[model samples]
Target chain A: MLKINGKPADAAGLTVAEYLARENFDARKVAVEINEEIVPKKNFAEVVLRDGDIVEIIGLMGGG
Target chain B: MVTLEDKFTLGGHEFTSRFILGSGKYSMRLIEAAVRDAGAQIITLAVRRANTREHENIIDYIPKGVTLLPNTSGARNASEAVRIARLARELGCGNFVKIEIMRDSKYLLPDNSETVKATEILAKENFIVLPYMYPDLNIARDLVNAGAAAVMPLASPIGSNRGLATRDFIQILIDEIDLPIIVDAGIGRPSQACEVMEMGAAAVMANTALATAGDLPLMAAAFRQAIEAGRKAYLSGLGRVLSRGAAASDPLTGFLHD
Candidate 1:
């Protein structure tokens, strides 16, 4: 029961990379944050998810 | 004769093209074409929560070697803006940022005070902070003092496409502010962009005008030409204005009738 973008998902033991791949996100295009701290790209594969872990993914979008 | 070699430098980064294209309100597929047509070496973008349903990503469309100016558009306060800027850097988009803190819903006005605060914080963090603000000289000075890489004064309200409604106010920033003056927002046409550059603006940022246009690439090209033309004219030094009577371009002695 991990929170990804405020929605609960069963990701108790998934690495950041696994979660991204499972969710069908192109890991190269997004920046991941865990519990208010940004996880740099180099650490995505090693950073593991636990119960109630909050994940926020951000991407470059259209803006003025 | 200001060629592309006369590059504009902001925050220690020299850009060959002064036109900064905004990636907003347009299809991602058109971004490359628009950027190429505008000859923009710097492009601005906004960060948002990744869409869970769609696999589409705008970053994939941006060409390599172009600098990314990620903006804090949705931030309503200084701290929020800071968070957004930091996140953008962590995303590996580099340190260039456009601080836009707008809480006003009606007019969509930038919060200048918050912008200054964000600039002070981010500038110390080594981010090249470019804050958008209303055309006010005092605030512009404050921003410069706060280590802002550049001061962006609006021509009018955000997304209005009204074109330089605050001409005199913007002129003051251009006159006194030592930092680069990039005119942002409310510019409706290529001619308006040209007009501001002619008034000595360092550069211009336009989005709504191109987004709403029927032909985005064509409009981008138009803006590129206009900005170049205006910059050349400003470099050439415009002639003085007269209150009464016309000044003849050719000498009176050279007239055929004489």
Candidate 2:
């Protein structure tokens, strides 16, 4: 049970890359953070999502 | 004569256009047109939770060669602002971050102290910090001491389109602060932008003015012309005003009737 974007998810053994692919998120368009630390794009394939880990996926938006 | 060589340097980048456009409250399709019409070299953007449902992204619309200035609009404290800034950088936009820490949701006024703190931290990390702050002299001084690249003072509440309610204080920052004074927020019209430029502001940033206009691209062009006109006026030096008596521009000694 991992918290991805404040919601509980059942992804306990998936790598960050797998989670992003499953969720249909373009890895290039979004930045990933696990438990308040940024996960660089190169490490997405190796970093695994553990239970209780918090994930935040952010992207650029219209702003002033 | 003002030449093309006249430019303002921000965070080691030189910009000839003094109008900074905001890419909010409007359609993404209009961004390119607005940027072209406004002649803006720098534009502002926000970072947020990526929408899984939508495939379109704002970055897809921005034209090439324009610099991105991402803001921390949702952060309520220094740490939160720092996190947002780091995330914005991770997105590969650039190192420029506009520190906008706001605790109040109503007026959306920036928290100056938190902004100062964020500026200090981000500047230390090599981020070109541009803190949007309420018009206060002491805080502007503090931000300069905190290693800010520029000080953005609001003319009024954000998105209000009230137009330069904080004129005198903004003028103070322009007069005293060594860094570039980019007037942001509540500038409703091209005239207001021109007024600030004439007051020696390094640049003018607006979003709601164009967003709410009947024609966004046209208004953006108007703002561009007004900013350029005002910059030229400032550079050429404004004419003096009369104190008590009227000064005639024509020769009084040799009138046509006389």
Candidate 3:
């Protein structure tokens, strides 16, 4: 019952690390924002996801 | 006279190199070498959503201790640009952003009004907002009033490699606006980069010119040298131009013929 990048997923009561791992995302290369608040990198393992929580994963890409 | 070691500040950050490199359309393997060859202290990058799989990260390719200037390339308006800038900052890359809010897909021209609006918001949020715009003195003034760190005016359409098609308009901005004017897009050659810098631009940012070159590192070095030479010439104070008269290099009375 959580939104990861606008798609609903059952990640309630899961830590950020578990959610990223379940989604097969390399946490080292992505930054996560939980419910419009940027969760610092160090807190990923400790920040637990709640029902209806929105998560955004940002990565670096080519640009000018 | 300003020495090569003389540094300038943008958004309270000091930089010795006037050249800023854009990281796009080039191999990530060459990014570090290109930056080193260019002697650039700052480089720009873009952000996007993660792919949710194992892949190479662009940030890993950048050298240590270099400033990462993230750009809002996909945003079509002010609020979108602001959001992108905030997301980029949350990634631990400092708050230096290149605000590129282009709504015109055909020409890829920045919407000046929206750019000014983005600058006002980001600047208030403590981001070092460097907004790209078409060269206009009044718009440049509005950006300055909005707390922009610098006003980046395109020399031509994005990725066109046309080289300073808007020279007169850019000149007006240089003559009128007080902020650091960085020439951003459509620069094809190193000489073109030199031309704008010599015309009193505070800096030059080149992407396609280097990305499409035969040798990326060598072309980067060429741009670095050209920018240095142009900045030196500008600091030395160029001589006046005469339309109908010729001025001899040597004194008239000191020549052998005299």
Q: What is the DockQ of each candidate?
A: 0.77, 0.91, 0.66
lDDT tens per residue, model 2, B57-88: 99999999999999999999999999999999
TM-score of every candidate:
0.95, 0.98, 0.91
- Residue B42 error for model 1, in Å? 0.8
Candidate 2: the clashing residue pairs are none
Ranking by DockQ: 2, 1, 3
Candidate 1 at B231: error in angstroms? 0.6
Q: Model 3 chain B — which ten-residue stretch has the worst lDDT?
A: B249-258
Q: Kindly report which residue stretches of model 3 are placed more than 4 angstroms away from their true locations once superposed.
A: A1-3, A6-13, A34-37, A40-43, A46-54, B250-258
Q: Report the C-alpha lDDT of model 1 over B132-221, residue by residue, as the tens digit.
A: 999888889999999998999999998889998998888888889888899999999999999999999999999999999999999999
Enumerate clash totals for all models, in the order shown: 0, 0, 0
- List lDDT for all candidates, in order: 0.91, 0.95, 0.89
| TM-score winner | 2
Better of 1 and 2 by lDDT: 2
- Regions more than 4 Å wrong, model 1: B254-258
What residue pairs are clashing in model 1?
A: none
Candidate 2 deviant stretches above 4 angstroms: B253-256
In terms of DockQ, the best-performing candidate is 2
Tens digits of lDDT, candidate 3, A1-64: 8888878888899898988888888787778888777788889899999998888888887789
DockQ of candidate 3 (2 decimals): 0.66
